[model samples]
Target: MLTRQEITILQELAKQYAEIASLPIQKEKRNMWLKLNTIQMERPMVLIDQIPWHEMDVDGFLKTKVSDPHWRGIEWEMRTAIYRWHHMPADLVVNPYICLPRIAENVGWNLPFHAESEVGQYGGQAQTHIFVNQLQEMEDIEKIQPRKIIVHKEREAEMLLEAKEVFGGIIDYRWGGFSSHLGFWDFISLWMGVTNCYIELMDRPEFMHAIMERMTQIHLEEIRQMNELQLYDINTNICHCSQTFLPDLPKEGDIAVSGNAWAFGLAQLFTSVSPAITDEFEVAYMKRIFPYYGAIYYGCCDRLDDRLDIIAKLPKIRKISCSPWSIPEPFAEKMPDYCAMSVKPNPAFLAGESMDEDSIRKEIRRAIAAAKNYNRSVEFILKDITTVRNDPQRLWRWQEIAMEEVQR
Candidate 1:
């Protein structure tokens, strides 16, 4: 149960959120995102990530005090959400109601893990030594089974009713898995260890193929089951792909299926592997998974400059991420017309002892110019920023520079 004080804090935040959502600019931004997503216009969108906040000072803003850990976590999230929307110049649409009581049907099963990292770390920015792999032997693969989506109806309803009572009118409640970042290749890397997985591709070719085949089956089955159960996941207005919103997507009432929402896939772990190897291990199975989605976003922080030929073959891939390491000049020249380029600028500009606005501005201008030289549809996503040296102003400044370059 929420305390009287917690409820008051939530109510206050909801009012502020409501004010932003009610802005006419919000709808304009929404329409612009729709245009950007459909590849009709070249409006550049800016998306600021939540990574830097982990190392920044948020003390002065977190005024709400809740003794319970869960409630305190909620308070902290609300504070961050309010701060980012109000401060950052990203192309974000502030909805009239905040999201509360969000829930997903627990797919009753667990992907066995052999190695693990400490929480709040290994967020893809830092590389760590793999210490575990549950599948140590070939026989262990049999333990992997198809997962079933277990919808806890009573618990989901109880939480929804409670949220409605608290801020039902002030904020909207969404249910089901609307956003997914689970790329089975990454899941494979997690279970098999990066080095071991790569080595097995050449050494134990048959074994690697077997594992990939099973992983593909599990992922496809999960998606099919979720849709069959009417698990609704709406991405129509959500910024899952760059800053672009999925305008023609499912609603909260529609059935949750891959055909209605955006699905993301990448093989960043296969960065060092040969394109042919990646085609067999990563793209081959991804072909099976990508067909299920209405639209797909591919590539992460991995450099895909050389592997573009292989990736172009995947189905329904609409946006490709041009990482900081990817050669922007050739990437701009080679980007396919059917898909938009999502550029992920190096996050290191925001980190370290001191921030370099000049260097940051230069790089942003260069990236933007490269995209324009080829008349490519592009969006700049500033993410994977591990730390900001506890400086919030750096991100704000970076956003300003990025937006300026976009408008230029």
Candidate 2:
């Protein structure tokens, strides 16, 4: 419930959002993203992101001089979206819909150790550390159960009606989260501490296999459950490794299944593991899971220079992530013609005492030169930016360099 003043402010923001979403340029940019994702010829795309907003140097980024905390939070998100559209180089859509979920909630059995991270003094960028090994023994795997999803039918309908009354003409209302981006190995690493999980892979191979087998089934069941509930919104276009639109979607009906949308997974915890171990544990299970998806976007922050071959072999793998540590030349060479190369440039370029324009240009040039070979599809996703050194302008400059390369 918003006060009259707050409602007025919100509706004004909604109008601004509507204006942007209705732009002719929006449609053109969208088509470009769709073509790039579908492995067609187009200029390289760019997606700039800063994971933790507190780490950014943008003054008053979050703070709004409002008495009501709820309205302030809403203002924060709306303002951030507006700021990103104006500043960042990403192909962001001004979706006027305030999307709400139709499904209830899924709560998993609690693991003993929680996911934790430590933020630095400069900016609130966290150094994550997981300290749990719930699956130390084979017998512990029995405790795993499929999450029960509860649908809030009355509440969902009430909210949708209220949204229609308040922002019906200005912004649309819709239900989202029909599809999912699930990762089996990523969850396993969290349940079992990363180090212990790695050691157990070598020590207790059978046990790891059993856990993966159960985990895969659990996810498959969960996905089917969404379909059974009829909460899926198939009309919404989602952005995964690529910007997916109506044209890129499968010809299937509106059902909540992996084959309906993009599925992304990453095992950054397995970054240092040997290829053999990787193949036995990670690759084998991923093959089982990825088959359910219409398209796949594999790897995140993890350097896939070593495991690119195995990942490239997966069914419907559309985008392969090239993290900061991955050498672009080899990644470009190995990236399948059918798939797009998604590059995650190092964010460290902006974290130093000052912006290193020369170094940044050189690195961008290298990536451009490598991917330009054979005109392979490429998208530069600037992510993992932990710090901006109290200067958000560095990000804008970096985008300038990247967009320049695209034109060249």
Candidate 3:
């Protein structure tokens, strides 16, 4: 029953290396995308998911404690993202990813939808209080009452079942359910503030360990339920939560980047920590998490270039995210043959600073070609594309040019 499009998204949802990427976008252009009848369904927007917003007031947080608009908001965001996928092909294939802005707003995070900004930095997101910070807390963390974790995960499962029933075999739910944007470091930013979390990492390593341990415990249980229920999605913010469907999958060779699907999926991020610290502090923890998934993908916000040395350290990584900040030269040279290289452009492009039309076109072409040259499947994800949402022509032109360049 899932629309043909939903089915395509679902298929990727089931894959370990299901690619997650984005690109510049526009609202008027989005409206046009919804209107288009092209059903390649193979385009990015086919994935399923939901959004996770932390830092809500008691009323807002408890609202979901019962049943709240945040649940309903998931449906709203999914519809919009799915509609967009139908209109034009996206650079990075994205599943549904969304911010819990409305729920946050309703529950009193007081998030505002600004006229100039398609997405906002403040008031719209949540504050994540859970973490792997306490090593001793891991046991207690594992026992985290579903009552607490369900603050959001429960609603996600409900939506996933509903969507699955509505869409049927057309969509994939295994690895395509609810994921996180407020992952590891991002969540630390929510609770302690990025700078503060950073400070604690240095001044209070013990505190940091406790947070990660507990967070990891909570994450383990969260994944266990979703994995059993076939609902835990691993994309940022969330695809099922954020949009109506799963993101498009990784290109051919990208799979080799993510260590392995661990039990189900892998959570990778770019912490501002130095390479030495990464080796000392992060790599071991990261390695522990990899063996549990079916496929693995690596690199988050961090330059894939700097982290490449440790790539092999990831036992079964199937995909690697290539950032604008990351250099693909090494990937092209020594990348494991099985890994998928997901190349990213600057989200700042949406701001239209250095990313003028000619420049973006050139940049995309170069990126695409570079990926192809390495025999790596490439995805162009403009994570924050709302910058040009109000301007349809610009959005249309960008899509048209991107399609023209990449299709070749």
Best by TM-score: 1
lDDT of 1 by residue, 18-122 (tens): 777788988888788777777765578888874655555556774657665544655665676678776784887765554432344555326666556633443
Q: Candidate 2: list runs displaced more than 4 Å.
A: 55-77, 96-98, 115-123, 128-130, 231-242, 250-257
Scored against the true structure, residue 63 in model 2 reaches a CA lDDT of 51
- How do these models rank on TM-score, best leading? 1, 2, 3
| Tens digit of per-residue lDDT, candidate 3, span 281-350 | 5565656665655445455556656556766577656556666776666655566666545555554554
Error of 1 at 165 (Å): 1.5
- Give TM-scores for every candidate, taking all chains together and pairing residue i with residue i: 0.90, 0.89, 0.56
Location of the lowest summed lDDT over 10 successive residues in candidate 3: 102-111
N/CA/C clash count, model 1: 3
CA lDDT of each candidate? 0.72, 0.71, 0.43
Q: RMSD of each candidate? A: 2.9, 3.0, 12.0
Total clashing pairs in model 2: 2
- Angstrom error of the Cα, residue 116, model 1: value is 8.6
Order the candidates by lDDT, highest first — what do you get?
1, 2, 3
